[model samples]
Target: MLATTIYEQGDHRWIMFGRDPDKAEGIIDTNQYLVISGEEAILLDPGGIELFAPMLSAVLKYVPADQIRYLFASHQDPDIISSLGLWDQALPNASLYSPWLWEGFIRHFGMERIRYCAIPDEGLNLTVGRIQLQFVPAHYLHSSGNFHVYDPKAKILMSGDVGAALEPGEPPLWVENMSQHSAHMKTFHQRWMPSNEAKDHWLRRVRQLDIDIMAPQHGRLFKQAHVDEFFNWFEQLSVGIALR
Candidate 1:
């Protein structure tokens, strides 16, 4: 797994870990984000069970295991937070912030130690040390109960599966070209995302924020102008293809 600092400004930093070349075959690659704000830190969508060892090893390279004070899952997907059991043992006192709808379901992954902080449907604001983060509602774009994290200070949005793509091998960390990248993301969004109404609602809300980087759980991240290009493309595409 490769760990890269996507954003940094003194004690406030956003480190993305993914693109693991040694990952087992047939398992989808996923990105895990770590946010550090002074003495506090949060791990977002910590990947599946197969990734726990490498993910933990990669994360410990920056912040100590104990300093990971928080965990945030966009929804209750196995790929999204199946490592909960392992993380529970690692960050015993850390709290997990996830949608209220999935508290009971997510707990099945094993929550003997970590406390669950359910995020309401309306979303909520959380402060980690010196930085303020927003849990933005993202229901039905893919999952029925989902939320994305937005950091206003870094102008970064951890969009979960909203911008995910399924590629065969390791790809570039950031989307270098929007037109070419659209092909990679098209099928995943059309099939996985089950609602056009939900997509519109999410687009409307996300457009209101000033975002510089759009970080998704799978595939490449979008930066600057590519971020706007993504909105323009996604806003017009019709999702829920399986129903048709």
Candidate 2:
């Protein structure tokens, strides 16, 4: 997988690893994020078992394995963090930050070597070198215990599955048109994100933040105008409406 630098300023950098032409068939495409702040770095949703090798190699290009002091799992999905065992062996001393509710279940992936930092239902602040990252609650958007990483300094929200879009092939890294992009997102949100209440709650919380980019684990990132457009669209769409 190719690791592309999506955002960088001073000692802070956000690298997205994806758009792999050699990705195995039947395996869903995923986007892994690496956030660097000085010497310390964090890997967000490091990906499934099949992606460990390439993902690690891509990460090592930017920072040494030891520099990756933290691993953030947005939820316990296989695509989200099934590589925990491999990551445990690679970064032996790093800590894994995830929702407290899934600690027991996710531990099955691997937690023997690395420490597991259980985030409360309300979420918490995680400091990596000079950057303070916020773990914002996104409960039941898809997972019963989901959370999103928000970087106040960068105004970027690593939104877990909140804004994910599934495309048949490689798509552009960012949304160029909101109307066109809505097609890629609508069905996924209506089907996978089972609760309108949770969706509305998350939208209200997100609107209060000053976000420049809304990055999801699955598809293209939303930036600037598209960010607001997504919020407006998500707010009105009735999630779980198909069930009735």
Candidate 3:
């Protein structure tokens, strides 16, 4: 079984483990996230069928599968939502919350079992007791339907692949070694964006958000000043700075 580490900043918590440490060429290490609200929880990106056991095992550390009330995906990439069917089978009562943009694709997995909600034009806010969630438009960062999630209360952003790294075998998923992680981040930016214009657009827009903890799909979680530096580095990378 793949091992995972639990990372938390107050009420905001995430459990990340392994899939592809090196990230391969076009391959990526699938990441799963959970955003807790009151007694209810919203999960993000359920990943593959093979990952179900490990993912479920990791999530149970914090809350029971039956306790999960919602599941959300940034988009409907196979790696992001395949295991959702498993979650539906495992936790029958939990509702799936996804970007309505890709509901058809997601429904293919859950079949009739998948109930969905569209991403709002003005974005959405989910409250689970005291915790609050805000959806940010990723626009062109990855895919048209893709979006990122932010927690204003915790200052944590669950950025899906926007700040990813091929950090295979990296321990502690926290910007523990920024220099090395920066190298991977640079390479990711190069291949992840479609055009310089889109890259520039994402950089400028993301800067307006108040971010403290950057919980990317891969690599480490960046907190505080490092979060600022990451945006600066991303701006440079978007303009063609060589990271490695």
Candidate number with greatest lDDT: 1
Q: Which candidate order results from sorting by TM-score in descending order?
A: 1, 2, 3
Model 2 over residues 144-172: C-alpha lDDT tens digits? Answer: 99999999998899999888999877798
Preferred candidate (TM-score higher): 2 or 3: 2
Quantify how close model 1 is to the true structure by its C-alpha RMSD in Å: 0.8
State candidate 1's TM-score: 0.98
- Model 3 Cα shift for residue 236 (angstroms): 2.1
- The local lDDT score (0 to 100) that residue 160 gets in candidate 1 is 97
Q: Which has the higher lDDT value, candidate number 2 or candidate number 3? A: 2
Q: Which has the better lDDT: candidate 1, or candidate 2?
A: 1
CA RMSD of all predictions: 0.8, 0.9, 3.9
Give the clashing pairs for model 1. Answer: none
Error of 2 at 36 (Å): 0.2
Q: Cα miss at 127, model 2 (Å)?
A: 0.5
Q: After superposing candidate 1 on the true structure, give the runs of residues whose Cα lies further than 4 Å from its correct spot.
A: none
Residues 1-244, candidate 3: write the lDDT tens digits: 3344344656555555555443345655666777665567778776766677777877787787766877778877787888877887888877676776778778888645545767864468866546777777776567667778887776778888777877655346568666677887776778765556766776676777788778777666787778878777776775333433
Q: Give the TM-score of candidate 2.
A: 0.98
